[model samples]
Target: MVIKPKSLLKNKALNKWNLFWLISGPISIFMIINLLAVDTSTGAGISEMIQFSVRWAVPFVYLVIATSSVQILFPGPFSRWLMRNRKYIGLCFAVAMAWQALFIFIMSYFFHEYYYSDVYYFRDEIEGSIGYIFLPAMVLTSFNFGSKLLTPKQWKLLHTSGIYFLWAYPFSVYWWNLYYYENPVLIDYVFYWVGFVAFALRIVAWGKQRYELSKRIDPNYKTPIESKMLGGLFIIFGLLVSASGLYWQDLITSLFTCFSMVRRT
Candidate 1:
């Protein structure tokens, strides 16, 4: 009798573990390369390495937060997949951000003389520090056991506020760079807009849910189809924006460079 091989991807119980490895494995490899292969002889190289890590990881962070909103906006196989795997996606995001934080710590503390210039100090003092405070709180509460410590309302408030705070980091960074430094990278714009769209989607969904709840108390209240239509429009707009961003040569080059750097190292 022929026996079928067990597939790790098909195992639902191990979904979180699979996500952990999927996200962490590449990040770990990149960190190793930065430590070993990247020429950190100059402070500029170290700064570039740090920026590289942040840019690559920010998309995944946005994606994790977008999962719920995306599911609400587009109810289908893709949306269902996102909803089913949201917990793992969120955990993976925390892991990715933790990796980014480690790189920042090393840069600030160990290579302070080389990397911690005036700009770095100013940025960290103003924004990075605030962002870091929320990171640990969100990460800790991401697990089921940790979440149980807080009332459902408390948990919702913390995560909702935490994600908004974290979202500000990339938005502020890219906007500041775009306006002040004149570095018009397509990917940065994509990240900023995607973050905005995700937040907007959530707000709309929440408002609609509340309206629906209130309608239950009234006999004449009717559910509107406009919400679904609006959701569909949002999903379509998101896909179009993402596709346009992916077509940019500069963004493609940057992604390839990042991957090649890791591969070569």
Candidate 2:
């Protein structure tokens, strides 16, 4: 007699709110522990916690960005699972960002000079304020109550714009860290590539999608992998050059440091 192993992908209870809690509960615990380990009595401590929360929050947003692409590129049980839980995953990001918001408020109120001088930049403030605005707007519109107010096209535009903006922020952050920053952390490399690859997958999937659409439009129209292969080559060459930046730091520092993120460093 053979005993079949249980497949988690088939489990209905594992998605939705259950999935949200399962992922978020441990994240919250670690976040609290991180808070305790820090000296939160000072502005710097609160600031550090804010960065920590961002690290915690970003992975969920990555999942949100890539899940649909994952389904498009490689449809399977795991991809389906990711697709089903996308909304809940988004909720997890909102909750984590809420934590950062709390810390931001604490720092701005109690450590005004530190928050403004050390943490705030007018350009970054504008970017982040736009993000904050999109955040709650996306959250509210995720549900039926808020969603019903918008037309389907409007709703789709809101989410698509918000997710891409959200993806761009972190991807740019890590890209700057990897390409321009001094003493970039190991996690900086990890997050940069992970974000890079996730978006890359979406690009590949889009190419494949357009290829398929073209064929459907004209069955006799022949298509070659030239575009796809060329696209892949560009990605490879770009990665090699970008990865080579570490050994040639002097070139970038002189050229790009003055242009450093308006207060992002």
Candidate 3:
């Protein structure tokens, strides 16, 4: 098949998004479980169940739809169809973020102390840390204040550092939970391993992109076939990660549900 440039770029974007979910989705699930199942309930147990279910289920469903829409609207085989629906995709992401913020507030205050205690722990650790400070920095830069107040280099630095911190938060939470509970579960190990793998791949990708730029800086430079080879390797890796993440998500959810059931009974 003749691969058009646009098609290739589109595929690359989808692959990136796929890898992103692989890294991010599991953390989302873990948070959802902690927010709903392990968290204390008030009113009727059924009411707690309903609230928890909505908070957990709806966000993921919206995430799937939004990310898929991003894949479709931005590029890939379905770009044309996706372009027509791009507004909906953006709206979905906005809605998802809103839902996420709501949970953050609920999980921070309304529930048992353990949930917010974790948040405060992170806040304390993250406030003074070097590379870790970027997560908040990036969120700041993404808004108008950073754009207007910070220099270009400062903004770039904030975003670059922020990306790594955002990725690290999930695994950090898992490890903290494990240490606190004194039980190292499979999911803990999975989070650490998969999160590191994802982070490593990201660093590698950044390096490769830099190498490509350096090569291009030379007047005689021609793009190497090795670039395509690297891309192909990443594509394969992306698929595997996506599949593994989905499988683990189901497994984790089931385990958490079982534990929650046992707790009540």
Q: Count of backbone clashes for each model? A: 0, 0, 0
TM-score of 2: 0.87
* CA shift of 247, model 1, Å: 26
lDDT of 3 by residue, 1-265 (tens): 8988656546644444453454346545655665466434542332344344333333332232233334433446554434443333333333334445565455555753645443345564453254334434544455586688899888766655554444444545554544444666675666555555545554555555676687879857765799879877987896575445634655776899999999999
Backbone clashes in model 1, listed as residue pairs: none
Which regions of candidate 2 fall more than 4 Å away from where they truly are?
Answer: 1-6, 224-233, 244-265
After superposition, candidate 1 runs with Cα above 4 Å error? 1-14, 114-118, 121-123, 214-265
Top candidate, metric lDDT: 2
After TM-score superposition, the amount by which residue 233's alpha carbon in candidate 1 deviates from its true location, in angstroms, is: 16
Return the TM-score for each candidate structure. Answer: 0.70, 0.87, 0.39
Candidate 3 overall lDDT versus native: 0.50
Best by TM-score: 2
